[model samples]
Target chain A: MVESSPPTRLDALLDQLATDLEPVKPLDDRPTALVLAGLFAAAVALVLAWLGPRPGLLGEDVQPMFMLRSGTLAVLAVVCVAAVVAQAHPGVGRNSQGWKVAAAMAALFPLVGAVVAFTDPAHARAMMMMPTGWQCLRMSLMTGTLCAVPMVLHLRRGAPVAPERAGLLVGLASGSLGALAYNLHCPFDSVVYIGLWYGVAIAVAAVAGRLVVPRLIRW
Target chain B: MTSDEATLARLMRESQGGNAQAYRQLLGLAAPLLQRWFRRKVAPHELDDLVQDTLLAVHQRRASWDPARPFLPWLAAIARYRWVDRLRRSALRNHDALFDDISVESGESALIGRLGCDRLLALLPAGQAAAIRAMKIDGLSVTEAAAQLGQSESMVKVNVHRGLKKLAAMVDEDA
Candidate 1:
């Protein structure tokens, strides 16, 4: 009788894995998209239930600035969420540069606001005198929190190569979603108000995500 | 994608569907690739363990792979993540072992140990080299090294740890 050599450790591990293996559904981008959509719908619904929409929201002559602000926030939220979702699938040629472009586009809001504020003294004074600006900041952050929690939970399912980047994206996504929801009820449409308060709120969320998210999703 | 990658991707897709034979074959191919990838990044003693850890990671995160994408990059990313994780773990271990136990005795053997380290020390920052030389080669205690170097005791320890880590990295690169 011929005797065979012992099975090596790797062989043993492989056999064990194969024995324990079960059918698994491949991860797709759709589930993440659906999650984000649901969250947005919920946030919008909550806003409508808790605080009524700004007067003339459904009117024919709705403010152009309001549309622009909401549209920018919507785009930012979608782009950031997409970037975060892409982290789950690791690939060499795959890149998530869309979020950066979206972020830059979003930056235009604050930049134009800053330019307007500096060039026009009256606008600057108007921004400074608005007492409800802090309320806008608080409300935006609060709304962002609604999105950030579930988004982080969803992110935990995948392995992100750069945890810090994923975290930052999650924060930005949530903050934008929050800002978008808050925009429905926010009566102030000044470029300065949107730029300073909304921008700060999103920046704070991104920083917080950078600090906090990596710790939760490391591995 | 290369033919090899196409085959692997097909195998992966089959494995995801509970095809044990395909899954086993995929892992069989993956093990050697992981070994070669890890060989350059880790010591010989750690090579097998790193390969196995990466294989286990690949198994656990298999679902993370998007079918439409090429397979090799996804595998490479997972391997890179493991390599980094191993480096971090070793650094932490070294940090914890910093002040465990040391005898301040000098002899010919110690001199022999110091012979080749001058080259290594030269590659480090001046402060780090000085701290490493005082504490490691000369067999000085942390306090003694700090007093001799005119740095704080904590700074001396920090420099020695950092210097040792750099030396390890240099050796790794050379290997």
Candidate 2:
């Protein structure tokens, strides 16, 4: 049987579209860097305006554990931003090593906290449920919300093949940024408090991203 | 990747930057693949419509393509979505016709039925009518209709709801 030539309509449509086509501006080569900078800047501004940085952030009394907490959150934020950018275009990061790296970083803080808590058995229970855990959760979510708007706008500019995945990355990135910002103000030096409360806030942000991204970026 | 894939990717990137020639070339290259893809599932006559629909979707969503990624996968995903949407609409059209046939047979004269259908559709603005046709008569999901119409999903849903409500009001007045 003669296969009819592929329809001419495609040719006509292409011709029509070509006639109206406008030159597209070049995409930013490092949108992830730009977005990360934006998120950090937003978070820092919020920190300075509302809750000043931790009193001892630069003082000699600053604990070593505080660095670990903030450092881990920063790593998560950076890795998640990379993954989100990778996913902004579907099929770009099929291997998705970035996500695995982000996940490992996310796990590290909690695992280290658990180990430290075990070493100090008497204070373990109290540190596990800090009195200000809710405050951390709220502040982290607020920070995530602040960062999410700009991140989502950036992601929307790209063609994300998987809206859910794209949104998830946005949420994770935003949540991490939020936690990083909250860390500046959070006084609790206990690893357990940082691990549990910051984790909750990031999870909430991730879930929110999953729910909201698909709708916002559908083009 | 093959040279063709690399060329396609370059074309897509260039197209994104407003090179009309590259955009045309990219679509030209994509058309055959889309035709083959759609032909596997749909009738021969419906082939052009599906191909056109997929191309339109790609045009609208082109900004989402990442320059670093292979272009074929992005194009393939859009084609696949449009094909599945066609299958869904085909199924719904059949199902709706079964019920619509009963109503047409029961009371309305054939001429009146035709007039009523045309008149009701005409009552709506072009955008609303197109939305109603795709969503109501054609059985497309709101997302599917939105993509086809180049409108947001919410806008499609709103148009369909409002168009149908108005049609119902008109029927009541006629009665």
Candidate 3:
């Protein structure tokens, strides 16, 4: 056999890095997704049992619209989670498409809300701002903070090429899940409140993620 | 897809399992490829250093590797990152200080008097090779080289740096 090239300082560095190396148990995305889903479910259940769904949600006329709003929020949560997982692996193409899809969905909610509020003319201003706006924002943020813990932990297991992007996705995921949970407790069925407050909550989490992820995930 | 790649993947998998021997063997196997890759981007004297940096990065970040994915793309991404880092650092180096260190006879004009550069030039990427030919071998200024190549002056500087680095690697390899 041909002799290998003479060893260099790289050999030493490699040895140093590999010393006391333990086998890494591979992190699968499926389990992470399940855990996030379970956490979101638990949060929603707790909120429902404690405060109950919006008072008028049981009525026939309001129930369908409430279900529709909650369903949209749930879909947003799932998409954000998928984006977060996709960004965890290095060398995987940047999940721009996933981000774009999430953004479109996010944008769609607000645009639809604006149209509905303006057309009604009766409650447009009232729908735009509410006394409970601050509460909704707080609840969403609280939910996001709780959910971000697991999301960040899962992200730490992988080599992310873009930490900021990964963080933003994590924030979006957690924030949306938080909004979904908040939706269970929020009695206001007005599209304006849901669109504006929920959007801001997600944005806050995303900005926080962008700032925190690079530092948190750096190897 | 190739057997070489398959073998490399196997070695990486073994290395991830805390196999030092396999890890060492993997680094050894990676050296020449890393050398060639760095050569196309940096100078000869810097080649070994960049290669070492890449190796260290690979070692430190090895845990992030997914066994399900092919190994080379992951390694390439790390190498590319290191290359960009080196370029950024080089750009920050004091140019006047660098110029003062070179002897008059070792300037581009004198260096172009030699004929052996063609063989080495052939080994570089097209953009870098052309940049070197116009700026170094032909003794054109950066502006002239940029105009001749229809590229930005900064781009010409980058190409020249990368080409010279590759030529230095060839000399070192031959030596």
Which model scores highest in DockQ?
1
Candidate 3 lDDT over B47-125, as tens digits, reads: 7888888888787678777789878766765665565456546544533211112122223332221212344466689
lDDT of 1 at B66: 81
Question: How many angstroms is residue A21 displaced in model 1 relative to the true structure, after the best TM-score fit?
Answer: 0.5
Lowest summed lDDT window (length 10), candidate 2 chain A: A86-95
DockQ for the candidates, in order: 0.27, 0.17, 0.17
List the candidate 1 regions with Cα displacement exceeding 4 Å.
A1-6, A120-129, B1-3, B95-175
Best by lDDT: 1
- For candidate 1 chain A, the 10 contiguous residues with the lowest summed lDDT are A1-10
lDDT for A209 in candidate 1 is 89
Better of 1 and 3 by DockQ: 1
Worst 10 residues of 2 chain B by lDDT: B96-105
Whichever of 1 and 2 has more lDDT, that candidate is: 1
- Which pairs of residues collide in model 2? A22-B18, A23-B17, A23-B18, A24-B17, A24-B18, A158-B64, A159-B64
True-vs-predicted CA distance for residue A170, candidate 2, Å: 1.1
Question: Worst 10-residue stretch by lDDT in candidate 1 chain B?
Answer: B95-104
Candidate 2: tens digits of C-alpha lDDT, residues B1-175: 1226799889888998888988887888777656555443454556689888888988876876767767766675555446545644553453222122111223324323322345546767888888877765555677778999999998987776676556533321221
What lDDT does candidate 3 reach at residue B88? Answer: 45
**Local distance difference test, candidate 1:** 0.75
Q: What are the clashing pairs of model 1?
A: none
